[model samples]
Target: MNENENISVLFKIVVVLIIVGAIFGTFMSIVNFALIRSISNEISTLNNLTISSMNDRMNRMDSDISSLESNIQPGGIVDEYINAYNFLSNTNLDLEKLLTFASETPDATYLTVYIAGRSNVWITVTNNGQSLLQADLKPGLSDYVFFISGNPNVKTSYTIMLAPSSIITTSDASATYILLAQNGKTSILHTKSPSLSVSNILK
Candidate 1:
């Protein structure tokens, strides 16, 4: 072959190689960008799903709280309150032993619950009746449980509050509460329509 023809052929080959490299790089860039966008979209969808679940849980809890309030007695049934909490939190919280010690704290915030005239009493079982939380608790009265430890979120840090004046108008100026002790933990239970006594149980 003539030297001039050979040189021209070589030049054409180099140009073709450069074009191929550019095409390959453009294809890879497009693929990478698409993959990144897909990942971002997936994250957004997951976040939305998470938010929706949280909202549903909150709504359920609110409804349960309302139902319990409607059943509060003038006095209050302690065990019933605990049952309501367990129903809402889905935690097996015991308030029995805690009830035995409830009298230890008197006149404390959320520490003292009150209902009126035996209105707070409820039946836990067929004939086993007990006060809800306190006497002198007005009908439709709303009670708020404030976080005292500033860490109701930390499993080991959530400290429950007690309301004093619980069951006011009692002869001793002392109130009674139904303590629930579950899994070695004690708490006050509330109820909407708690059975007044074990005897009140429906067989």
Candidate 2:
């Protein structure tokens, strides 16, 4: 009878040890799951913050590009710069033309005349018996003619002649005035015939 009682006690102790091991395994599993979940949450939050920072940087870059485009639009700094460059180029061209004309006559006693016409015409300037100048004058085009008499004290006479260009037909000959300037005096001479004369213009 005693032997049977001891066998029963040993069986009961084994059952209790098995139950405790199962409970400890369950508790360890819960702890491990909680740790894993907390780590995953932290990583997700970091990714979101990184994405937000990148979006802010991209937004700032886009704003800067838009502002730059507006600044380069019409009537802006870029437009004004182009206008100034063109103006300076034209001014330089005009100055070069004036310098070329001034080099032709250096003496103070020489008579200088500028001839301009509204229509295409052929021009000639003569003093005494010598030919002084000849050129073709067109609309917006002019020529500087210079002549010097042997004696500056004596007044000089110049015979000016104007004729239609070869491109002009008789029917196409319209009324136009040729401008002549000398010694601060400007004469608007009418083109009526092929020949004209001016005697009173003096240096």
Candidate 3:
């Protein structure tokens, strides 16, 4: 072929390459724009979710604070202590012994124990193997009271056993054990043992 023909062919080739490159560039730009928009939307959605989570946590915190405020009682602990003190003061007994006996009862805050011998009986009250009251109680109303820690967490248990007079002693003696809780709840137990003298007399 002649030089002019070759030159025309070369010009056509260059023009076609330019058109292809322009089309490719446009497609790439469109793809890049779409990717950027998708990335921006995802970021925006993540940000909104984070904000919503933060707001929910803040609301929960506010609710907790409100609950705490509502439950706060003024001088509640002081009132418990005062009640215990008044109960103890009324007994007019050895405060130390009464307090010790109260300390021995288990799962209790405060207690008022009343034990009546109903006869000339030996009264032995022990707490954790330690003697609290070991005396002879006569018939009629027995004046036994106690005051423990007003705090419910403080706890102990006691054992009260009774024996008859020297003339009528027995291995197992009749006993009356009473447990009074701080809330004025009473639980009385009349033990039936080798002798029913105490229960019969008290009844």
Candidate 4:
């Protein structure tokens, strides 16, 4: 081949290689972007589904607790517990309600509300064959002590006493609050409250 033809051929080949490289680069960038977008979308959808499912489960559980609370004997600190539960289940952050419910600026009180676990014992009362439902610590006639302690489930068994200004709190939220309490025996110890309440409670 002539020198001119050879030079022209080399130039054309170089140009073609540059164009091919650009096309390949553009294709790889588009593929990478699509993969990233797909992964991000999948993650977002999964997160949304999980959150929505959790909220639904919480709502159902709140309904069950409300049903059980409705069976309470009208006037008890149980109403206060229901209030605390309402504060817990709501999504629209009621700062005022939560602060008020958890407020302990004045002092602590007696009567603690705990999560509904084995603490409840369903009972059936019959008066002249008329059935009345009552719940307690046991299926038998045992007092359901609603006392406040650092821990809701204090291993020590104590009967409910009408104590004035006994420390109280509630498990209104998931987070546990640390508490320091003294039982007047020159012993200093700390406990935690689920939520805050007044200091006076009648057993």
- What's each prediction's clash count? 76, 0, 4, 7
List model 1 lDDT by residue over 12-82, tens digit each: 99889889989989999999999999999999999999999999998999998876776574434654564
For residues 97-185, write the lDDT of model 3, one tens digit per residue. 54455454455433333333334555554444455565564432234443343443333343323322111122324333333444434
- Least well predicted 10-residue stretch by lDDT in candidate 4: 184-193
Q: What are the candidates' C-alpha RMSDs? A: 19.7, 15.9, 17.0, 19.5
Provide the global lDDT of candidate 1 against the true structure.
Answer: 0.40
How far residue 197's Cα lies from its native spot in candidate 2, in Å, is: 40
Ten residues in a row with the worst lDDT in model 3?
163-172
Query: Model 2: residues >4 Å from true position, as ranges?
Result: 1-17, 82-91, 97-203
Question: In candidate 1, where is summed lDDT lowest over 10 consecutive residues?
Answer: 121-130
lDDT of 4: 0.42
lDDT (CA) per prediction: 0.40, 0.48, 0.49, 0.42
Our tally of clashes for model 2 stands at 0
Q: How many angstroms is residue 70 displaced in model 4 relative to the true structure, after the best TM-score fit? A: 3.6
Q: Which lDDT value does model 1 have at 119? A: 36
